[model samples]
Target: MDSILNPSTLKNLVFDLGDVIIPIDLTAPVRNFAMLANLPEDEVWAIWKEHNFINHYETGLLDDAAFRAEVRQLLKNDVWADEVIDTAWNTVLLDLPVERIARIQELKANHRLFLLSNTSPIHIRRVNDVLTQLNLPTLEQLFERVFYSYEVRLAKPSPDIYRHVLTEAGLVAEETAFFDDNAANIQAAAELGIQAVHVQPPMTIIDYVKDL
Candidate 1:
């Protein structure tokens, strides 16, 4: 894999959603769950962090109803309302900053921008609702193609998903650059010959592409 990426050689840009484009706390849901279940935050956090349900839900193996039921089962509270489950599950989702949208718009001029995210249908609906409220363009308007884990039945760190996008877009791996917040996803893309960058916290995607 080549460590040096020349902006001039890049023709496509693949971006991750959470923590990359939109800000996500990732642990906000634990607090919400604790409050709803009247359990210690640490306890709820422990269960959530160790659960495989989230990955299953994101990969389309579990539907919304099944996922909610699993959450209730984990909390040992079957009396929880659907509203409570939704609120707790959505706590990690935050607004998409206007600056990031501006950056994407700017990048649109020269690159075929695409989105590949490991997210559930519920979260995607919430994100779209937020975008609507903000009077911003929908994800479709921002990217040429949007690939969600639930929709694609595949998630990041899986080479098949990366290959799916590349094949579908008719894009060459060496000519594409992928930006993700997870190190594992970055490694997967890199292994497939895509120039991958791990966009860490305190450093926005704009900062990563400013030099390009």
Candidate 2:
């Protein structure tokens, strides 16, 4: 599709929810959780490794209840599980830049837009809250449809999730271009023949599409 050229020649645009649509700064909550639990940052991080949850969820191997329970147990703490989850979850919903929101709207006019995220109902609710605060539109109205790991029982970095998006969106691999902050997820999309971009700050998906 010659993504390097102007307009990127994409028929559909699939975006990752976390850092792409919404800005997520993961460090604050991690440090706070560590201090509250009196645990080392690395140990805490290891305990809550996203791959453990994302991999299973993406493959439809784990449901929300089971996933949440596992996350709670991973803390191995005597504290309340809901509180722990809340703290960890809220930390990720750091901020959403208005500039990014406008950019997505701009692209929607020319191409089919879809959100493919490895997230849960709880997180989705929080995201909506943030969106409301920022005066941004909801997922359902913004894109064709929003794909969530908990809602769809599938996540990124797995072929199943990518397959689901492509099949449901009726987009050919070559016609679709994916943008995600996660490298593994982007690589997975690449393997499926979908053009993928790894999104990092100062190098946004919009930057890749500006001239187009």
Candidate 3:
């Protein structure tokens, strides 16, 4: 509801991962692979939509295998199925930067932190690997807890997920601040009375929270 930075001086900070903490390469891997395999981009996206693969995977309804199998089935062409699955599933994941990681570390000193991400098993694994490679502190070091949509069975833009997180943390909406890249999701949280920050690129979330 309120966009004023630090309006509530929150005791808890909730973060969305993809496109917020980690950069996403939405087109490169999927598009390049589709072109190489001679599959139409529209058709591939059709499969993703049909199965609610993106939402389901993000919400934790589908595992990596199910995600892969669903895409393969959509192709209906056995020969190209595996390649299609690989590209569609792996293309969007990218790395986390050290500066951002440090910023998170800085925020830890002031807020009770938590992560709420709509992500799949595959990307979660990759993100953890990136975290390790960067030699950054473990996610546990930065946040009190981590909630994945897949594990929670609730995705963003769904009030239930936010309620669940608030309940789990024993926090009232007025005492918590949520950060996300999607406007719809921020609106959803606002509807539930949680302060929401619309994460924009080139603006550090740390700057959004640091004491003025």
Give the top-scoring candidate (TM-score): 1
Residue lDDT tens for model 3, 1-212: 33665544677888888787777887665575466557888766665567666777677677777766665566554555554565456668765667777877777777788998877777776677668877776665668999888898988888899999999889888778888888999999888878788887677666676562
Give the Å error, residue 175, model 2.
Answer: 1.6
TM-score of every model versus the real structure: 0.92, 0.81, 0.87
Q: Write the per-residue lDDT of candidate 1 for residues 1-212, one digit (tens) a residue.
A: 22466788999999999998889988799888888788999998788679878989999999999999999899999998887888878889877788988888898889999999999988888888888888988887789999999989998899999999999889999999999988999999999999998898788989888866
Q: Pick out the ten consecutive residues of candidate 2 with the lowest summed lDDT.
A: 1-10
Off by over 4 Å in 2: 1-8, 49-84
Residue pairs whose backbone atoms clash in candidate 1 = none
* Per-residue C-alpha lDDT of model 2 across residues 43-93, encoded as one tens digit per residue: 878766854764574445776566667655666664556756665757868
- The reply for model 3, stretches above 4 Å from the true place, is 77-88
Clashes of each: 0, 2, 3
Off by over 4 Å in 1: 1-3, 49-51
Answer with 1 or 2, whichever has the higher lDDT. Answer: 1
